[model samples]
Target: MDSPSTPRWRKSSHSNGDGGSCVEVDDANPGHVRDSKDPNGPSLAFAPSAWNAFVSAVRDGEFSGI
Candidate 1:
């Protein structure tokens, strides 16, 4: 995992103003995800391909109504 200090973390645009159900991603390094509510907590990293697939599934609503 990359050092959290150097990573450029950005909150999702979809994030609520009150900070509910939000995620943060580090564009400085691809494939890293951290909870917006817990910036110092552990992050989950994925391969670029895997991350794309995950995003595609999300856009397609594969997990809708779950």
Candidate 2:
């Protein structure tokens, strides 16, 4: 198990192949997110429920208003 300060990070499979889109998530730190391009930059934290809802919405195309 990874420590809180060094939570395991994994790149999103949905990211662009050309590396234009880079996003990483820490499973050990649920609801924690940060930009892969800026590991030392700021991070965003959300409630686990909120995070799950956001992911679910994206997967369900709930935000496809285009």
Candidate 3:
């Protein structure tokens, strides 16, 4: 799908200053994820509901320490 117009990238709050596994997300269009190290690289877009579910899972520690 076409990239959203001028997506405003926001750095993840969980990102450490050492730059180890950082992620950037586009709030302009929810569910869009791009690597912080490669802003111009490909992005993964998910449906809003799916994204919410994924976030919920993360919050619930469904995928922890793996």
Candidate 4:
């Protein structure tokens, strides 16, 4: 893992490529997430299990209406 302060971030594959609303996730620290439009803003961190559950929920359309 890299330093938390400078982890490598990747955009969601679902992101719009024309500078639209997007978020970035750190590869080195799987649960670290930040807004792509606000790189210096505060980021959210989750426990690995929590992150996995969130991802699973997204894949299952559990957040579609919200």
Model 1 regions more than 4 Å off: 1-5
TM-score of each: 0.72, 0.78, 0.80, 0.77
Give a tens-digit lDDT track for model 4, residues 1-66: 544665889998867889886989999888999899998899999988999999999999998897
lDDT tens digits, residues 21-54, model 2? 7888888887888889998898888887999999
Model 4, residue 1: C-alpha shift (Å): 13
Where is model 2 more than 4 Å wrong at Cα?
A: 1-5, 64-66
Best-fitting candidate, scored by TM-score:
3
| lDDT (Cα) of model 1 | 0.83
Candidate 3 lowest-lDDT run of ten: 1-10
Q: In candidate 3, what are the lDDT values of residues 21-57, reduced to their tens digit? A: 8898888988999899998899998998999998899
Of 1 and 4, the candidate ahead on lDDT is 4
lDDT of 2: 0.83
How well does candidate 2 match the true structure in TM-score terms? 0.78
Best-to-worst order by TM-score is 3, 2, 4, 1
lDDT of each: 0.83, 0.83, 0.88, 0.88
TM-score of 1: 0.72
